[model samples]
Target: MTKPIKILSFNIQSGMGMDNRRSLSRIAWVIKCSGADLVGLQETDKYMKRSCFSSQARKLARLLGMHYVFGGACKPAFFSRFGNTILSKYPIKGHKNTLLPGTGEQRALLDVLININNKKIRFCNTHLGLSTSSRQKQVNKIIELLGEIQLPTILTGDFNTTPNDPVIEQLRACLERKSVSTESKNNDLKTYPSDRPSEKLDYIFLSAHWKEICQTTLPGQASDHLPLLAAARFIS
Candidate 1:
């Protein structure tokens, strides 16, 4: 059997409605269409009590028919009203939320270890701070966390920076491969400002252990940014 893994990464924008519109259903459908084996989401929110709080990672996971891990990067719960989430078809063996310290706002790095056909892989998902300075700190924490894992790595989420930026450079410095475009029509799918996307804020990166066969950006949206998906194989 082929040991190929399909992964998707998205920034959902928390399904917020400035026009008083909620579109979680729409977001879910777009994700389903991607046919990804695993998904990394940003800006997922949920309401705990009276206060509108939560990053709806669990709900989205259920909708996708997958298991999930929510990483609390900023606060104990809902500091930024959002956090990172990972939905996977493989069984999760381990997970941790790595916190990034900075003055602007709290950020998160979610790490999950999963077993697929007995092959263990480590998946990292996160949404970085907007400011360049904040991202440097977050990225450093990720590099540190990655050093502890022996499984193949797959990192995904809204970087809030472009491929040419310094932060992305740092990410590429460690990761073996990065997805720029896709054949699944998900390539160059700019996701920011639902009205019109100009910035490429999402990604799915791979380690040297994985061989990428195809990549694409899906068309359509339930959030401000579109999703990125990639098809990869374990290098023989």
Candidate 2:
């Protein structure tokens, strides 16, 4: 029998905590405390000045003792790769980084294939653009990509929009997936502006094929956005 999988989605803001201090160790500690098997991280840095020129993803993965892959969206000086990442306890069977359609800045979707109890599952990590129009196109592209994959998938990230946004509606129309937390609950439990969160910018959307066992947001000042933890089982 396959065991339930614990997942975490966090926008580490380049490892900058609420105190405006950068610490990858603190970010790793938050993720570790969540007890997640697969973690999707956004706003990660690679040799960037913000995080002391360290590869935030690699360092966090090493700290947590997990395999990791990073997707670069923007290179400030064409030297550092900054974007999203996926850290997994299971070996990554395969992976891909896709650039999303947008004009504000280059955004990407990082997909990793991992096996759980011999069953293949796809974990997608991404951080969408902040504009309304760009986000609309980006969401369309994401849905289009999901349509091509047959494996069970878990899409997690900071969408920068509320749960009622039309973008969310479009994604639901295509993937038929549901956010781990209910819309009302998400509104009540804002995740942004860690000091006084009042926005629902983060999410973990699971395909209809997966069964959600539990979902909750973790309290923290490690980053501006609080991390979300969820437990689920594949419905195979």
Estimate, for each residue in 1-236, the C-alpha lDDT of model 1 and write its tens digit: 28668898888766653354566667778878888888998777645331245447767777777888887654434444457788998889999887776557678888889998888888999888888878888888888878843567899988888766777766766776443333224435566655577877787778777778887667654666767778898775
Local lDDT at 161 for model 2:
92
Tell how far residue 30 is off in model 1, in angstroms.
Answer: 1.3
Which residue pairs of candidate 2 clash?
none
Tell me the deviation in Å of residue 129 in model 2: 1.0
Where does candidate 1 stray beyond 4 Å? Answer: 1-3, 17-20, 48-55, 75-81, 177-189
Q: For model 2, how does the per-residue alpha-carbon lDDT over 1-236 read when each residue is reduced to its tens digit?
A: 46889999999999889998988889988998899999999999999876778888889988999999999988898689889999999988999999999888889999889987688889998899989999988998898888764677889998989878999767655554443434334455578888788887887877766777777889989999999887887775
TM-score of 1: 0.85
Flag regions of model 2 displaced more than 4 Å.
177-187
